[model samples]
Target: MTLRTIVVDDSIIFRKVMRDALSAIPGVEVVDIARDGSSAVDKIVAAKPDLVTLDIEMPGLNGLEVLEELDLRGIQTNVIVVSAHTSRGAEVTTQALSMGALDFILKPDNDNAGANLAQLKSELARLLKMVKAQPQLSMVSSSPAKSETLSAPIVARAPVRTTKTTSVPRPVECNLENLKTPKFPHLCHAIFIGISTGGPKALASVIPKLPATFTIPIVIVQHMPPLFTATMAKSLDNTSALNVVEATHGMPLAGGGVYIAPGGKQLGVKADARGNVIAVVTDDPPIKSCKPSVDYMMSSVPSSIARNSLAVIMTGMGDDGRDGVSYLRQNGCTVWAQSAESCTVYGMPRQIIENGLADFAFDLDDLPNLLSQLAYRAGGYCPVPPIPSTTAPMMATN
Candidate 1:
C-alpha cells in the first residue's frame, strides 16, 4: 500500500530533498510539495495525502499555523513536523504534537548537511511505518478532538482497590505550599517514567492527575532535544501539583517533585556526600540512536527500591525502554506499560508487553490512580525530616 505524502517547506531545496528522501522509503509516494502554509493547506486538501512533512518555520502561515488551519477546517492528514534544532523550534514542535501532529524530525545544522539528510530518511521511514501499522493513529492525528479507544484489559492491571478511571481530568495550576520534604517515608520511594512520540500531551494528561497529597519524587526520560526538554518541564510544572523541573547535576531527588531529563544528555541519579540520591546529568554517548536513553537512565538507578518503586513505559515509537524495564524488573521493581489504545505510539510499551517484561499494562488514564496507590502503599507518609544543606553530608532516607 502506497502512503500518499506531501512535503511542505518554504525552501525549494528542502522540499525537493524531502521528496526524494521520502520517495525512497518503501510504500511511500510523494504526491505533492507545498512551499508555504497556504499552499500546504491547499495541496493537502487537493491531494488528500496520507502524510505531510511540515516545516515549522515556513513563510506566510508557518507549520503551526498550518496545523491550526487544518484543525479549524477539519482536514485530516498525518503531520510529521520538520523543525530546526533550537529551543524555540522545539517548543513549537511540542505544541504541534499536543495539537495533533504524529511526530517531528529535527533539522541538523548546515555543517553536516549530508549526515543530517541521511538521518532524516531513516527517521521518516520509521515514523511512516508506525502510522501505517496503527489504524487508531489516523483518528488521533486527523481529528485531535476524538478518542477512538481500543478495548484494553484494564482490569488485568488495576490494583485490587482501584476503581474505574472514566476520563482524564483537566490540568490545574501548581501550588508549592503543599510540597513536602524530599524524603518519601512511604513504601514507594520513587517513580521512573519514560516516553517518546506524543509525549507532551500524554504527560499533561497523566501528570496532572496526581493529587497534591501525592509525594513521591518522579524521574522522567522523555525522548526530546536539548531545549525541548526544558520547555516540557515548565509546561508540565505549570499544570501539575508536582514541582517539575529539568534535572541538573547534584540536585537531590526529593518527594513531591518531577525531574525531566535534559535533552541531548543522559540523566541519572547518584548518592551524594550525605547518602541522599541526587540528579546525575551526563554527556554520555547515545544508545540505540537516542541520547538520554531510557535504558541508560534506568540502569543508573539503584536497585534497592526495586521492590517498592514503580517503573513506567509510556507512549513512544521505539524500543528505548525495553532493556530498562528488564533491568528494573530483574531487580523486583513493578513495571507498567501504557496500553496500546491509550498510547499515541505503542512501540516502547509493546516491547515490554510482548517480552513478559512489563508486570502490568494499563491505559494511560488508569496509571495515575495506580501510581497514587503505589505512593501511599505503606499506609501513610513518613513524618517530615530535617532538611539538610547542599554541602551537608546526606543520610539515606526513603
Candidate 2:
C-alpha cells in the first residue's frame, strides 16, 4: 500500500529537494506541498496525508504552531520535523517532539546536501513502515474481519487469567534500606534494558516492584519521543520506590536508581577518572532510527561494566536489540528477553529469542520475582536457581 505524504517548507528549493528525496522511496507518494505552516494546515485538512515533513523555522505559524493546530483539530497524522543543524534548532525540534512530532531530521548544508538528502530518504521510508504497522490505529479502525487477519497472531499470544482481579496493591516506595542484597557472587556491574510499544504500561508495572536495595545502577532505552520519555520518567518516579529521572551526561549511576535516556540524545555509560560509571548523552547519529537505541545501549554496557553486565530486551516493534543481545551473551554478560505471550509487541524479544541470544526468557509479571531472586543471590543472602523457561502457551480467542 502506498503511503501518502505532504511536504511543508517555506524555502522553495528545499521543498523541491525534499520532494525528490521522498519520491525516491518506494511505496511513498507526495500528495501535496505547502509553502508555510498556515498553508500546510489547509492542505493537511484537505488532502489528509498519512505523513507530513514540516520545516521548523517557517514564517507565518512555525512548525510547532502547525502541530499545535493539528492537535487542537484532532488530526493524528505522523509529523516529522526538518530543522537546521544548530543548538537552537535542536532545542526547537525537541520542543516540537514534546508537542507530539514523531521524529526529526537535521537539515543538510549545501556542502553535503546530497548525502544528507539520501539519509532523509531512508529515514522517511522507515517512518512510513512504522506508521503503516502501527497496531493501535489498524486494530481500532478496521473491520472485524480485517482486524482479525492483521492481529490474529498478537491476540492469540496474549496471556489469560483464571480470575479477573480489579484491585491491585499500591507499589512500595523506593529506599536504600528496602534494597535487599543477595547471597550469590556478584556477576554484573550494571543492568541494561530495552523496551518499546507497550513499554510505558509494562514499565509502570515492573519498575515500582524493584527493591531500593538493588546495588547495581539501571539504564533503560525505551523507544519513544522526547516529551514522552520525560513524562514517562515522571510517571515512573511517582509510582516506583526508587528515583527515576531522564539521564544527563556526567551523572553518577547511583544504586537503586533508574536512568532513562533523554529524548534526542544517544545515552552511553562511560567511566570517569575516578573509575566510577557516569551517563553520557550525545547528539550522535541515531542507531536504528532511535536516539536512545536499545542496541546502542546494550552494545556499550559490556564495555562500560567490563563483562559484568546484564542486558534485557523487551516488547518492541523491530529487532533493534538482537545484535547487542548477541554481543552481551558472547562477552559473558547475562542477557534476557521478555517472553512473547506477555509482550504488547514482540519484535525485539522475538529476534533475541529466535537467535538463541537470551539466557532467560521471562514473563512480565514474573520479572519482579526474578529481580528479587537475582538480588538475593548476588548479596549472598539466598540461593535462587537459574531462571527457567517462563513461556506460557498461547491463548486462543474467537
Candidate 3:
C-alpha cells in the first residue's frame, strides 16, 4: 500500500529536501509538490493524496488556515506538520495538533544540514510507517472520540461497567495465574503516563475529562522536543480542571497537580529528606532516542511509592515505557494500556500489552472513568468497583 504523498512548503529548498526524504522512504510516493498553502490546498482537494507534509509558516494562507479550509471542505487526508523549534513554531505546532494534524516534525534548527536531514528522514519514516499501519486514519479523523468531550463540558460520569477481558491478546510467555491481581487501585498513590506521537491530542482527550474532584499527583512524559512540551503543558492547563505545568528541577510533586516532563530534558522523581518526591530535570543523554524518555521517568519512581503507583502507557511510536512498566509491575504497580482501537499510534501500549505487563487494557475514553474510579477508591469513602476481569481464558500469541 504505497502512500500517495505531497510536500507543501513555501521554501523551494525545503520542498526538495522533503521530497527527497520521502522518496527514500519505502512505500512513499511523492506524487506532487506545492510551493504555498493555496496551491497545496488546491492540489490536495484535487488529487486526494494519502498524505501531506505541510509547513506551518507560509505566505498568503498558512498551514493552520489550510487545515481550517480542509476541515470546512470535510477532507480528512493525512497531515504531518513540519515546524521549526522556535517559540512561535512550537506554539502553532501545538495548536496544529489540537486542530487535528496527525503528527509533527521539527525542522532543522542547527547548521548541520546533513545530520538534520538524516534525523528528518528517520522521524518521517517512522511516522509514515505508523500512518500505513492504520490506513483508515487521517489527521482530521484520527480521534472521533474527542468530539463529545469537546462539545460538552467534562462532567463526572458513572463508573465503567464490567466488561470481560477475554478478548485481549496475550503474549506467550505470560501466565495469567502468576499475574498478581491484587486490588492495587485502592492503594494507588501516583499516576505516571508515558505518551508520544499523538500525545497532545490524546492528552487533550483524557486529561480534560478527569473529574474536578480528583486529587492525585499525575506526572506525564510526552515524547516531545524543547519548547513544544512547555507549550503543550500550557495548552492542556487551559482546558484541564487540574493544574498542569511543565516540570522543573526540585519541584515537589503536588496532589492534583499535573506535571509534564519538559522537552529536551530527562524528567524523573526523587524523594527529598522529608520524603517528598520531587520532579528532577536532568541533562541526561537520550534513552531509546528519547531525551524525556518514559523509561527514564518510570525507572526513577521511588521504591516506597512503586507498589502504590499506577503506570499508564498511551499512544506513541516506540517501546520507551516497556522496561519501566516491567520494573513497576515487579514492584506490584498496576499498569493500564490504551486500547489499540483508540490509539493514534499503538506502539507504546502495544509493547506493554504484548509483554503481558498490562493488568487492564482500555479505550482512551474509558481511561478518565477508570482513573476517576481509582481515585475514588483511594479516598475510601465509597466501595469502588473492581476492574473488569477476563471471564474466559486467553491463549498467548506466539
User: For this target, which candidate reaches the highest TM-score against the unseen true structure?
Assistant: 3
lDDT of 1 by residue, 1-398 (tens): 56888899888878877887897898888878988899999988787888899998877898889999999989888899998777788788878877888788887565677776778788887787677766666633233322222233222111111112223122234232222112222366577898998888888888988998887788999998888899888878888887999999888788788999999988866544444657877776676777777876776665554455778889987677666666667667777778778888777877766666665678777777777777777543322222335532211211
Judge candidate 1 against the unseen true structure and give its global Cα lDDT, from 0 to 1: 0.73
Model 2 misplaced stretches (Cα beyond 4 Å): 112-119, 129-191, 195-216, 221-251, 256-293, 299-318, 326-350, 353-398
| Candidate closest to the true structure, highest lDDT | 3
Question: What are the RMSD figures for all models against the true structure?
Answer: 10.7, 13.5, 11.1
Q: Write the per-residue lDDT of candidate 2 for residues 288-389, one digit (tens) a residue.
A: 666777766665542435366677888777767665666666667777778766775667776766555666778889888787677666662221222224
Query: Which residue pairs show backbone clashes in model 3?
Result: none
Q: What's the true lDDT of residue 313 in model 2?
A: 85
TM-score of each model, in listed order: 0.78, 0.55, 0.81
Ranking by lDDT: 3, 1, 2
Residue 87 local lDDT, model 3: 94
| Residue 287 shift from truth in candidate 1, angstroms | 2.4
